[model samples]
Target: MDFDRKQLTNEQLLDLYKKLLKPRLIEEKMLILIRQGKVSKWFSGIGQEAISVGVTAVLHKDEYILPMHRNLAVFTGRDIPLYRLFSQWQGKANGFTKGRDRSFHFGTQEFKIIGMISHLGPQLGVADGIALAHKLRNEGKVTAVFTGEGATSEGDFHEALNIAAVWELPVMFIIENNGYGLSTPTNEQYRCENIADKGIGYGIESHIIDGNNILEVYTKLDALATSMRENPRPVLLEFKTFRMRGHEEASGTKYVPQELMDMWAVKDPVTNYREYLKTEKVLTDEYDEALRAELKKEIDEHYQQASAEPAIEANLSEELNDVYKTYVFEEVNSKSNSENVRMIDAISQGLKQSMERHDKLVIMGQDIAEYGGAFKITDGFVAQFGKDRVRNTPICESAIVSAGMGLSINGYKSVIEMQFADFVSTGFNPIVNYLAKVHYRWQENADVVVRMPCGAGVQAGPFHSQTNEAWFTKTPGLKVVYPAFPYDAKGLLATAINDPNPVMFFEHKALYRSMYQDVPTDYYTLPFGKASLIKEGDDVTIISFGAGVHWALETLAKKPEINADLLDLRTLQPLDMEAIFTSVKKTGKAIILQEDTLFGGIASDIAAMIMENCFEHLDAPVKRVGSLESAIPFTKALEDQYLPKARFETALAELIAY
Candidate 1:
């Protein structure tokens, strides 16, 4: 335990022994505490203490550590007291997060540790981004990211490796391949014989080590850590170990076979290493017993201190958040003109105009650089503004988004596309955790615009076709906009990019090429949170955005006998409630339409909003139109059958006839 105090001596090998033993002892103490109902949450780094201490033995305290959930042992290996770690586990105010974070999500500037993100694969990008910052600042420190074998399957892992390798970042991507990612065996996840082999695709040095051996783990990580700090390139390390306990408390290990457990339990790093030390004459029975006693005392003192700290406070309510701070952002009001322009051209021109006005505006996405984006939204953008501004990514949605947030952190208007909006789920964690809370937590605004090709009418099936705008709709501190026409698309995109908060700007794939409306060439930006009254009527309010607007217009054009007020909600979150309430109040009847699924769709949210604020003003019940509540089928016929366009005419007929 004393070896964790920083200063080491040649005769202090016994103290070093205590350092390795402390984490497991701490975990054992926490486990008993759990049984006694004193501790609520804890990730036991039980069997793999060697991997944590051994690897961190070579790492400097000043360097960055993008630790995983169980890597709290590494934090304990350093100067972070067991009390604070346990306080974090107990979700108490004594922890560095002061009770704001859940288990393993707490760290501090003193630790030089980036807080652990619970979601898999996101740390790869956050590690890469912090490394990117170190590189940009011309610092020599390195970033070591801890992840699991199962996380390698995530797109962000591949993308982070590709970006890190290409940039030659000072990072070590370490995979604690502990046989299973929450009971899903590694064999089922990847075909590569060794986890380190995945690094070859990224052109980085890869090492597979006997992770249970302290000497080997330390030596391998030490050499790599040296090369990483000097060469400033990425490295992948596969730590072959086993999880002695279930992935989490209250987690069942029924999925683990007895044969596999028998095979791995013998190779348990802590037991084998302890025996190895005893057999090698490096440690004595007295030394082992004494180390255990000292570690126990430290654990006891820490727990007592943790239990005595003040309880969690409620002053920092979740709603009292500053998601965007001191930013001159005005809500956009839509302006209608008798002008027509192509949706694709509107997007391009809008970005083009924004780039002209704002010097720091930048765009990034897959296929955006060479192909000018999959739908030509970035066409002529790279050529005009250069590749640095309109950069292309390697199909890593999570990393792509986190990188955009990183860009925004240092003052750049980052606009990233998720290709098809359906793929946005891949980056959901970063959007929800980092992008959404960065302003609130760090008290700094990360002005980033996330653009996606959304909706399901194109018959692209489950993977490519989806109207999932609502996935992030309920996520406060984020502004989501659906640009319907060329003019609206252009103006809103400009507005989103310039705004100092994360914005999801969804462009319908069907509208990209279908509708044409003239957009002015003048460099102008629109405000956020505004709606456009496309067509005014006194009978009913057709509430929609994106493809819904097009459907409403077409429906009205086909039936001149039916009068409806069409209000386009240019911005979804921080919705144009004024316009929606006004139009619905005027018409006294409402029909909400969106191309997303009816289950968890934005229509339901709009309906709830109307019912909450404008219910008494309504004459008839509010109705919603969206995709059926089922997985989008691959067959073109089935896909069409599942899409809103197939049912739009019928719904409109019924609504109008009523």
Candidate 2:
């Protein structure tokens, strides 16, 4: 392939040289600023700028690029204004995240570059989603993602590569093998001969190249980009390079050997390209000095102008202003007013109606297409909506969420189903870090719905049953909904799909078929952050959600002497604290019930909130009843003892007596 490759003209080589020089100068300037205590820290790619320059030179403006911190040259090649970059570094209002985040942690929707998060692996999976949208739209565009050798050791890296190969998506997985993962060496990271070899097993084309040479990178990437435009296949290209500096400006290369540093310094990409330009007659002594002077002046001016911009003022009152998009509930006509419906059937109907109403809505999960999902919630969906709309995904949870994020960014609503809630830990990074922060950082709507089948009591054991909504409720920019009855499940799931934010809809596994109620088979969206007052009485106020609501209701029936105002907190994230406060004020006592463990559960949070708001009106201390602080067992007897019905009855009697 090298023998058959075309040579680059002198003019083209010169352009690549200048592109490499700009970021090198910026890194050098930033390093000085760090020494002067002007900038906080910096991640330099002094020896690997050619990788970014070569790749960005071949990409179109409309195509997307997700760049890591070391790949700052990609922004320069994309023509993003230097002042904006400086403003971001200086933490000014003119910066990308408006000074909310530091360094390469922001994105521009206009440039189609999603700013990479601090975590390394999620971006690769997210790039799969962007490529998926391009493929689905028949757009002959490719998405290029940059990461290092250490990132490939992450599970998401393998998940991203596997799915990209399986789908034959137009994605370029570029790995800059700089031989270090922060302080850890490459050998300690993986046992493989090379990172590119890992891609070969995924059935994708793999290539390794000399990353120090600017012309070599540009020529090869140019050819690869052209071929992908026509054939649309992912390419795993490894750029063998070195990190010339420490991980950041503050941390010097003490962990790196002096001999290794001396060896890589001789082959520095920027200096090597500068000499290559001079030898090729593209630069003279005077021109080289003038170019350096011009770049330095420009970098200095941008830094000064960005530093003079207004700094963002701290305002605690408007903290949650842009955390979630404001949603207003609108009336949707009921197609059928039937009351006889099971919870699973109601959820299926909601998904079907929403898909039929909005042509852009898509449902994706493992065994969802023909097998109809693990519990058959999305069964028969493929036959009705076709496999494209009702997609059967590979068993990669992280990729599934990333694909949904990519779809939402491209103006599509995605409904993703995790086979069970216990498995959400596998996909937690994208959901919490990327999808949850998109709106707050970029104001971009990631309209994705993750259907979570949670809770124990069906003998699914610790691996399958989990009520982990508490973990997500504490995270900002996410909506957590747990419905108890069929009516709320159908209405809330419909609303969640239509809502313009990332939503986690948790449906208890035990209530899927056991809980039946008269649900309206219509297009209606229930308002989030509003609790349903199941029964109103003033003796005591009981707060519950999901399967725990049934336990509370059962306890109330068992002890008819205890008059309680039972409130169902439908959405836990945007908590209905107003409803809670009102009920607590009337009753003068409160009891919080949940199916999760008592240690650091939703019950604990709600009990605190009640104590804060109604401390004066309290007749007694706020009581909380939840599952035991242990994993849910396989046997029904142990599971029953672990969960809350018996505990709730005991707590209810104590609260009434108190």
Winning candidate number (TM-score): 2
CA lDDT of 195 in candidate 2?
89
State every prediction's TM-score relative to the real structure.
Answer: 0.78, 0.96
lDDT of 1 by residue, 1-658 (tens): 0012123343444444666777777777778887898877666666677777776778888776767778756787677877877777776766655455677774465676665566667768867766766666676768888888988888778888888887787888888888888878878888879989888877888989877766677666777788777778988989888787888876857888888778877776666666756675667888788878877888898888988887876775542655555457655443544456678888877788778777777677888886988887787787788876777777678887876765554446777888888888888889988877766553446678888887766777788877778888878678888878777778778777777888888888887777887777654567777888888888888888888788778878887987888988888876888998989888888898887788788888789989999988987778888887888787878877787865777776776657
**On residues 117-185, what C-alpha lDDT tens digit does candidate 2 reach at each position?**
888888888788888888877899989999999889888899999888888899999999998888999
The positional error of residue 221 in candidate 1, measured at the CA in angstroms, is 2.7
The alpha-carbon lDDT assigned to residue 37 of candidate 1 equals 85
Which residue pairs in candidate 2 have backbone atoms (N, alpha carbon, C) closer than 3 angstroms, thus clashing? Answer: 339-518
lDDT of 2: 0.87
Q: Against the unseen true structure, what C-alpha lDDT does each candidate score?
A: 0.76, 0.87
Off by over 4 Å in 2: 1-10, 328-336
Q: Estimate candidate 2's RMSD in Å.
A: 2.1
